[model samples]
Target: TMDIRKNKIREAVQTFENLEHRMEPVATVRGVDFVNDSKATNVNSTWYALESMTKPTILVLGGVDKGNDYSLIKDLVEEKVKAIVCMGTDNSKIHEAFDGVVKLVDTANAQDAVQASFSLASPGDVVLLSPACASFDLFKNYEDRGKQFKDAVKSL
Candidate 1:
């Protein structure tokens, strides 16, 4: 039993690939990588996504805010994110929370958010969709949001 478990663990580690919607790589356009982390519906998950980023990031954030405390990611945002694209109905909270921390812009949908994030990204930078809120405002679920983000990145 111990040997079987060890073998399974080794095989899984060698073949493991993370799920499509959580920290999934969508595409590389003009040297900038696009990533979908639409499963980040909470501050802690977004923190993990932001923490794993190795390059400057243009973050696509915003959805139906579940009273999210934007302060949770404030230091990480300041350290890693170059810009932010808000893709929610009301962006006032995001603006207020991130004002002076990083550049912020409001976008209507996934496509526009991707375009805006791309424009802000330079070569070696990344565009990441790690919305830290509920997807009910703009998508059927986190999977839908991630799919839309991937489609938009592919179109670019």
Candidate 2:
């Protein structure tokens, strides 16, 4: 079992390494780079996005939990995050995790959330909408949530 776990971790790590190589262009873009990583849904994926940011980052994090641990991104949150936008039914976890660490706000839907995140972002800042949980609290799925985020970016 332990060997299987190690192999799984190795494979996932390799996949993410590949992802990181491909994601540099997307993550490094100047201006408000709205990253709709709504499919992240877990603490690990959120940490990856936070680690990859090349600019001041406003991370949109929240939604129905498949059980999310806010601790994984703590160091990165303190380092890279300018603000946190909670886009979910309840924002308690997000607020609790980042209360004294950074500015926090809550928005119910995609459009308002994007607008609010954009407001917090400067021209070179990155707006990362990595929910670190499920999207059923608002939109249909991660794709729906991602598309809405893109549309909102276009509107901006």
Candidate 3:
């Protein structure tokens, strides 16, 4: 009985799917993958998302700054990111942090961010929405942000 239970647990773990707002693959439109990682509301979480990328990435970053230290993910961004789309009202800090590191585009909403990211991406690239700050600036919460990102991807 114990052996059977252990095997069942292992099977469940093996079959587990990614959480909704954490590295969730929203869609693959025109060979460009759109990923929503809105639960990543801090620099460290965003770093993990970037570290897992195997393809060139257009990262959608920004939100209500939570005293985030962009330096924590600077090296990973330099290595993995081809461009950054800032989806927030004020993106001066994001631009300052990534100055000369990569191309940066500022957007005010989810749809614009997705469009900008898609335009910047080529086939086989990824557009990752892993905002490294809180969502209160433009969204009610992280879940709302993730949903908006998914909706934007569906429109593409």
lDDT of 1 by residue, 48-102 (tens): 9999999999999999998889898999999999999999888888999999889
lDDT of 1: 0.91
> Can you list the residue pairs that collide in candidate 2?
41-133
lDDT of each: 0.91, 0.80, 0.93
Clashes in model 1: which pairs?
none
Top lDDT hit = 3
Tens digits of per-residue lDDT, candidate 3, 1-156, equal 999999999887756545789898889999999999999999999999999999999999999998889999999999999999999988888988999999999999999999999999999999999999999999999999999999989998
Q: Could you tell me how far off, in angstroms, the CA of residue 61 lies in candidate 3 after the best superposition? A: 0.2
Instruction: Tell me which residue pairs clash in candidate 3.
Output: none
TM-score of 3: 0.92
Show how many residue pairs clash in every candidate, following the order shown: 0, 1, 0
lDDT score at residue 33, model 3, on the 0-100 scale: 94
Q: Could you give candidate 2's per-residue lDDT for residues 23-99 as a string of tens digits? A: 32233333667666766778887888788888898888888977677988999999999999989998888887789
lDDT, candidate 3, at 22: 86
Quote the positional error of residue 56 for candidate 2 in Å: 0.8
Give per-residue lDDT, candidate 1, residue 25. Answer: 85
